[model samples]
Target: MIDGLVGGRLYGEAQIRTGQNGKRFVTCKVRATTNDGDTIFVNVIAFDDEVQTALLALSDADSVALSGALTPKVWTDKNGLIKPAVDMVAHKVLVGYRGES
Candidate 1:
């Protein structure tokens, strides 16, 4: 039931890594600015090959729009420190090119 505006510049390029099952996983960070002038950062992960490919093509300044659920993850680091994190499970992605209305 998590929903909100999720779109912004690619803070960094998408990185592909191998998962436990040997499948490829892609992850990236986005910097979004809200109407209230609040800037927020979000991490996005894509499991689908096509989606992953599309995400990787985006440059650092590229704009993208996505709609999806926000899921929080909690874990303990090797040093036994507890960490909490959150990311978006994108259902749609729209690439914005320069000068495009």
Candidate 2:
């Protein structure tokens, strides 16, 4: 799992994109805060079509809970640099509005 948060806070938006080959993918960057107020950034990705559509419907600043596995992807960039990416394969998703608690 890629079940962590990214950005500067717990709230953020997920981005969905379709490749030229018609492959769909969803990415979410969330900001996770530690108990001490420290923050970490995480990037989550969903490749399943159904999950992608669901994630795409989520708007910015929405609160979402996701469960998934972690996957590492590596590729070479056009500048001849190797890039490594870690993503999540979301299996469960819960969407909630702000202050829903």
Candidate 3:
């Protein structure tokens, strides 16, 4: 995994869920713009309570910065087409990055 920062607007409300093993985690989706002017969505997960608290206070309008390790993901579409994507497991997150948005 490579370290990176993903900056973009929060896509929706950050969700807090408990894993089957009883560990709580937070997840947020970010809509990052590509160099080609297109958009790719990334789902960032935070297992740290401090980071989760920070993410909980931010709104979807906020510009966020996620510092973490990049991960690759693959899924099969409804049409049975294989698609690839990138996700980040954020160790640190800077929420409400923009003063106001």
Candidate 4:
């Protein structure tokens, strides 16, 4: 688990959904632009209500700073194609703030 501040822009509407066990959480994608001009989408999740509340305040135009666990994920896409992706479970999320570091 890596802990660092990664800055990115919200790519879509973050949705709050309930898990099988009835726990609520939020999920969305943050698009980070690399120095090479390529974009990387990081799937960000917040499993707690307070964090969820914070994440849901912003929209696609806002930038965010994410802090938590970063990991890789693999799943089948709409075309049934196997894809590999990166994800982060955010314990904290800050919006409308420039990455001042």
Q: For candidate 4, lDDT tens digit of each residue in 1-101?
A: 87756688888889998889988889988888878876677898899677798788888858888888988678787999776556998988777645576
Q: TM-scores for all candidates?
A: 0.74, 0.58, 0.81, 0.78
Q: What TM-score does candidate 4 reach? A: 0.78
- Deviating ranges (above 4 Å) for candidate 3: 74-84, 97-101
Specify the highest-TM-score model's number: 3
List the candidates ranked by lDDT, beginning with the highest: 3, 4, 1, 2
The better-scoring model by TM-score among 1 and 3 is 3
Candidate whose lDDT is highest = 3
Question: Which residue pairs collide, candidate 4?
Answer: none
lDDT of the candidates, in the order given: 0.78, 0.62, 0.85, 0.82
Q: How far is candidate 3 from the true structure (C-alpha RMSD, Å)?
A: 2.9
Model 2 poorest ten-residue lDDT run = 1-10
For model 2, the superposed segments whose C-alpha errors exceed 4 Å read: 1-12, 71-86, 97-101
2 or 4, greater by lDDT: 4
For model 2, how does the per-residue alpha-carbon lDDT over 42-72 read when each residue is reduced to its tens digit?
4677787766766677776555666677666
